[model samples]
Target: MKVYSYSFKEGDLIPTQYTCDGLDISPHISWSKVENAKSYAIIMDDPDAPIGTFTHWIVYDIPSNVLELKENFPKKSVVGNIMQGQNDFGKIGYGGPCPPRGKPHRYFFKVFALDVESLGLPAGLSREEVERFINKHTISSGFTYGLYKR
Candidate 1:
């Protein structure tokens, strides 16, 4: 599987509209389908955070047939069958990059193909909690990254 985004190119600078400096909305993202995938999940984070890796978004229970998450995805706990988890910002749904001044930070958007349809987890769970469940069921994964700075 390969993850990608129309909001920005892989390893390119993310546009201001998707960061704290602007709208702070979730960027449009998509991924290639993986064989035998019962469901898919996404975890976006900035490893360059001052306090270690900081999760910007956690989305799971996405239907296997779905291929993309549109721009400015609603900040909801549960939408239809998909679940959005709480980010390091203590908010539910996407939290755009807001790194401190200086060097640009790399935000990684990772997509996982799960063996199960759902992790049976509720929304609003922390990244750590959700990741624990994802790790157990993940079959294949791919990622893309964008750089951002204040």
Candidate 2:
């Protein structure tokens, strides 16, 4: 599988509209379909965070037929069948990059093609919890990233 973003190219600087300095909304993201994939999950984080890897977004139980998540996705716990998990910021849905000034931080958006239609997890779970379930069912995965700085 291959993950990509229309908002920003791989290794490119993310626009301000998607960061804490701007609207702080989720950027539009898409991925290639994987054979035998029953569902998909996305985990976006900043490994350059001062507090270690910080999760910005967690989305799971996305229907396999769905290919992209639109920009500025709602901050609700549940949006249709997709479930949004809590980020390190203690908020649900996307939390745009807000890294401290100095070096730019890389924000990775990882997508997982899963064998199961759902992880059977509830909304508002932590990234660790969501990842644990994703790891067990993932059949294929890919990632794309963008850089940002305060």
Candidate 3:
């Protein structure tokens, strides 16, 4: 499996519309359909954050049939049966890149194919909490990244 975006390519600079300086919406995300994938999960984080790794998005329990997520999704606990968790920004759903000015930070968009239909985890989980569930259930993973700065 592999994740890619129509808005930006790996290692490319993310658009301002997806940043705190702009619209603060999530860019479109798509991935190859993995065989035997019962469900899927997605997380986006900035390891270069000043306060350890900061999560921008935490979503799980996406039906296996979903291979793409549209941009500017609503901030809700559950949308179309997918469970969304809180990010380090203390909010639910996607919070776009917002780094201190000067250096650009790398934002990683990770996708996981799971062996189970659901993680059985609740929504509004922190990044760490979501990771705990992801660690045990992920069968395969792929990632793509983009750069951003204040």
If scored against the real structure, what TM-score would every candidate get? 0.99, 0.98, 0.97
Which pairs clash in model 3? none
lDDT of 2 by residue, 8-127 (tens): 999999999999899999999999999999999999999988889999999999999999999999999999999999999899999999999999999999999999999999999999
Per-residue C-alpha lDDT of model 3 across residues 52-129, encoded as one tens digit per residue: 899999989999999989998788989978999999889999999999998999999999999899999888988888
In TM-score terms, candidate 1 sits at 0.99
Error of 2 at 141 (Å): 0.2
* Predicted structure 1: lDDT: 0.96
Clashes of each: 0, 0, 0
What pairs collide in candidate 1? none
| Residue ranges of candidate 2 with Cα displaced over 4 Å | none
- Candidate 3 worst ten-residue window by lDDT: 125-134
Kindly give the stretch of ten consecutive residues in candidate 2 with the minimal lDDT sum.
Answer: 45-54
Ranking by lDDT: 1, 2, 3
